[model samples]
Structure formats: C-alpha cells, structure tokens
Target chain A: MKTEKTLVTITEEMVLNYEVIFGKQNKLPPTFPMIFYRYINVPWDYKTAPIHRKQTCVCHSELSIGESYHCVVTLDQVKQKGKYMFYTQSLVGYNLEGSECFRCVSELVVH
Target chain B: MCVRISRTLTITEEKIKQYAFLSGDFNQIHLDQKEAERYKFKEPIAHGMLTMGLTLEIASSFTEKGMRISTYEMQFIKPIFQNDLIYIVAKKKKQDYGSIYLEITGRKQNELVVRGELALERLSSIHFNNATKESGM
Candidate 1:
C-alpha cells in the first residue's frame, strides 16, 4: 500500500529543537525525516505499532530550513512466518522540483 | 577505515522519553515493561531511531562544515535497554571527490548492539553535484 503525498516543511523551531537535541551540526541529520514517519504510518491497521528493527536513510541533496517537501510512504512487502509478521516500508521525500531529496527504508516486526 | 575514535554514554529513561516525545513514537513497547515483555525483551528498550540519532553524534565529530550524508544506515542487532552503557566507535573508511565514508559500531559492554555506516560530504553547498563552482550546481 502507498500513502497519499504529505507535505512536510522544515521550520525554524524544528531545526532549533533538533540541533539542541542532537547537536549544532550544520547539516540536517539524515534521520530527521523519520520525524514525519507517523503521518504516513496512519494507514497501518496494527493494534500496536510494529517494532522498528532496522533503518536505511539516504540523502540525495541538501534540505534547508523553510523548505517544504512532498513525502510518500509505501508498504513494500509483508511476510508472515508462524507467529511473526515482518513489514518493509519506504518513505521518500522530494523537493518541490520533484527531485528525490531523501529516502528511508524501515524494517518492522510485529507478533 | 584505519582512523578511529570512540565514546560512551549510558542510555537513560529520561533520554528515551525525551526522544519519544520529539519523534512522536509513543510505542508502548518502548515505555512499559509489560509491553516489552510481550516482545521477550527485559524492561523497556530504547527506540532504534533514538540510538540511530545518537550514533550520528559520533560521526559529527569527523565533520568540519557538518555532514551532508549520502547514506546513514543502521541495524538494531540487539535490544538496548535503559542504563546500558553504549560504547560507540567510528572509523574513517575512505574519502574521494568530496565524499567521505565511515563505519560505526555500537556495543553494550562486550556484545554488539548496533552496526552502521555513513557516507558524508561537507554541507557547504546546496548544489551538491557540480564539477566546478561556476557550473551552476
């Protein structure tokens, strides 16, 4: 399943809070986009949220404060093995120009 | 890969809760002991993303203008329980054409808990790909 596009904006407050929590690193943390994961995760029907087992994030270009991005989340695969269910999902963000700015692939597990 | 640095920190409940609030990951498994038991974990476990964020802290020390990461990948090999002293090591793997690669590993004492790698470049330019400054990157 794929989610409808969601617009995410990087605000000054967000950048400030992030820098305060993580560090004053001039570059945006790659995992910063994971903050919006919950928006697209609304489509899942699980009674409890799945465990985030692993993650892979890639940044294709620089993202600045005040920039807005369009994100789409896709449930890439699901497998059931006896008492366990494994889910793979990808959340991709694109700049207004439609260039892929960043992407995150998450592996989740539910029992 | 030969050059390396290491740091350690004890994961605290306060830190975990702080991250959950910031990230909007209100998973019970990360907050309640009972919920963690359901997953066969002892006590509550730190969110993988929280550790992932902390992992990048070590990587940031290697940066001058900060990091424009090409990739930040991590695997939660084992549950990181609160109070576990996490030892993190980062190695400079290689660099070429403005991009640098680093390998990182996290251990809870003697056992490996997380392993990852980062590909980074200086964050000085918004146009990341250009052969020259005047090419309109």
Candidate 2:
C-alpha cells in the first residue's frame, strides 16, 4: 500500500495569474479581491471547483455582466492623475516592511 | 522634519469600475451597494492600491530630477466609499544618507482611512536629466 499526501502553497504568482485571467474580465475593483483573499484561507488553485462564481450585485441586485462593467485600461493613467491625485498628497517617509506583499504581487503582476 | 501637504478627492463609481478592469478585482463590496451594505460597508469602496498608488504619485511629485521611490509600507484603517470626499495628507518625515522618508495618511472628513510610510532614493541629477532627455518628455 502506498500513501500520498497533498501539500498546497499559495504564492503571489498564483494570485496574479488568477487575476490576469478571471479578474481582468470582471468589473470588480482591485481592492475588493486583495482584501477578500487576505482573509480567506483557501488555495486559489483548489481542485474542488471554480474559485469564483458569478454573483449578483447587492446594490441593484443585478447579475448582468454588461459592457458598462468593462473597464478601460487606457483610462487608468488618466484616472490616476485626475481623480486619484485630487485626494492624495506627496511626501517623503522612512522605509518600512508593510508593503512587502504588495511589492511581490506588483512585481509578479505588473512587471 | 515633517513637511506635510494635503489634497481632496471624491471616489466615484466610474473610478472604482476602472480599477476593477485594470486590476481584475470585481469584489461586490466595491461594485454592488447592497453587497457592500451586507458586508457592513457604507458603500462600494475604492481599491487599496488606488489609494496607495496615488500616495506614491504624490511622493514622486516632490522628488528631485532623478529621485525615485525605493520602498513603502501602508496600513488600511478604513474603507473608502464611492462619492465620499476624502483627503490625502503626506508628510516628509526624515532624511538620511541618500534616502528621504515620508508619512502618508488618507482621511474622509474626520475619519482616518489609510496611513503609511515610504522612502525615496536620491539619484544623481545628471541621471535624471539624461533620462528625461532620452524620453523626450
């Protein structure tokens, strides 16, 4: 008789890939998934079933994935400069370790 | 030496949707109002990266010709919702060697939303000039 065990290691790489595929297609904001995964302990590659299922919006109670839901990547830079800058400020600060996970995900996804 | 600056921003549904497309995050808490309410959020919230990235941008604006951000650490204290008017406050905290340190905070009215620290590296002005020249900016 042979015994086999399964070991699961979830990395930023896996999350990045998941976002690249299913994430890009939906109208979900970036922060939602980041926070969602932060608290959930399930492997992104769990073989049981699709990790994400289509769900209705709680606000309007709509389940449609319409063209309006699609985001325009080209507009991101504009959005950042215009709307984002309006609310934030620029400064200099000491280095810290809180953003390590963010850096890993950024390097894996953006670069 | 804390040098601080502040600005105001209004989170919009369009911006949230745009971030969703760029980052591939469609969590209902940000898209569906009901979902957000169910999750105990006042409304659909802005992405944390959106706030963080904007903070970095603010830092970059204060940098000299060749200076660049080298590292940062942030903690989210509150959720930022669409249509909420928020303020971003950045402060220059310290300077040592060739690095400049900063502290950033985001506030909605009187509520604290996000806060963090960052470090910027000072590069040779020549490098900055050369890069700008090469890019033709």
Candidate 3:
C-alpha cells in the first residue's frame, strides 16, 4: 500500500484538539521569532475564527548531513471582516539525528 | 516501503468527543456523523492535527530529554474513522546543526492513512542564544 499524506489545516477545531490532547501545560509553540505569544493563552474559541487554507508538504524520506528539504506552507487570505484570520506561519526544523521532525501548526488570529 | 511504529490505536467516538471538548473544535466534520456523511467519508473522522501531535508521543519513546521537531509536513489523503486501530511509525532521516529529520507514517488496518516529514532541533544554550541574538536579542 502507498503511504498517504495529511494536509495540516488550521481551524478552530485544530486548536481545540491540541488543547484537549496536550492540555494547557503543553500549549502549542508560539509564533516563531516572537516569544511574546508564549504568554498569550490559546483561547478555546480560536477555532471559531477564520483561517487561511494551508497546504502541508510532508516529506517521508531520510536526510543525511548537510541536506535539507523545505516544508512550504501556503496560507490563504480571509474575506470576512472581524471574523478572525489565520496566516501561513513558518517554523525552523530540528537537528536531531534520529527523532521525528517538528510538527508545527500555523497562526490563528481575531483579525 | 511501509513500517510499523506503534500498536493500533483504536479510534472511537468517545475519544473523538474528548478531543473535541479539549480542542474546542466544533467542526461538523469531526463531531456530527451526519454532517460528515455529506463529505466523501460519510462519517466523522479523527482530526489531522490530533493524529500529528500523537506522533510526538511516539517520538518521545526514542529519546529521554525529549524530541524537538524542527520541521514537519503531511497530506490528508484518506479519512480515518473512529475505532480504527492505527499503526504508527517514525524513522530518522538526517541531522544538521543539532537538528534531526524524521519520516512519519500513520496507518490503519495495514492501510496507509497519513505520511509526512518532520525536522526536530535540539534546545541548546548556544543555539538558543544565537537564535535569540539573530532575532535582535
């Protein structure tokens, strides 16, 4: 059987799921390059906001030293006003030799 | 090629409900079976992120200080239903600058459900300090 891939879409439900599974103690990582969001709580209603359609590119191959692959995430724009919005957020990948790569999600907002 | 990483994790409505309650996700696609029927699957399915995060636990199994994923990507090609036992697998791909690349797969009943690549960076004082400084610390 062929291996299937999962596209990571940011919705209100996703935030809710993360909260339910990881709990507040395991909050989602903050927007990269900015730690200010670390203190901001992930509101349960975050799922109720509008989000960009995200395209996830998950590679399933191993890499050697000095090798790198890009995980490009495309963020769609929101049309509704004051309904909240999400953007295509980028994260730096890891360097562990054998562990799985990072599983980071995009950003959601009330914009 | 396909590999097995974990025991079959049975997907259940009750489990889905708890995830919904915790994630605050009210998407009809995951909660209302009738609503999901309108979709191709014709039933509620597990949240993609939920499945993604669950793999992190599997990553923890291989390390002690904990695994830090730096990059990850996946495509949702199949619908995974509740009560379905999913066999999970994660493999080491490569390493750069204390970061590791991983190939992850999730399958149910010997069928592939999801696959993706993940990159994990270790939390190091030198790396962290350099990263923070590069960001204008």
* Predicted structure with the largest TM-score when compared to the true one: 1
Model 2 over residues A7-76: C-alpha lDDT tens digits? 2233455445444433331222222223223322322221111111111111111111221121111111
Please provide, for model 1 over A1-111, each residue's C-alpha lDDT reduced to its tens digit, 9 standing for 90 to 100.
Answer: 988899999888777776766767567777898887655545766645588778999887776788889999989999988988899998899999887889999999887
**Runs of candidate 3 exceeding 4 Å displacement:** A1-111, B1-7, B125-129, B132-137
- What TM-score would you give candidate 1 relative to the actual structure? 0.90
| lDDT digits (tens) for residues B30-56 of candidate 2 | 788887777566777776665564445
Residue B83 displacement (Å), model 3: 1.2
Per-residue alpha-carbon lDDT of model 3 for B9-121, expressed as tens digits? 66677767776555555567777777677654567877665565555555554334543444456655577777777787777776666666678777876788878776655
Off by over 4 Å in 2: A1-102, A105-111, B124-137
> Model 3 residue B13 lDDT?
79
Estimate, for each residue in B11-124, the C-alpha lDDT of model 1 and write its tens digit.
788878887887888898889999889878888999898889877877766565565777899988999998889999988888877778888999986899999989887655
Task: State the displacement of the C-alpha of residue B6, model 1, in Å, after optimal TM-score superposition.
Answer: 0.7
Indicate the docking level reached by candidate 2.
Answer: incorrect
Backbone clashes for every candidate come to 2, 16, 41
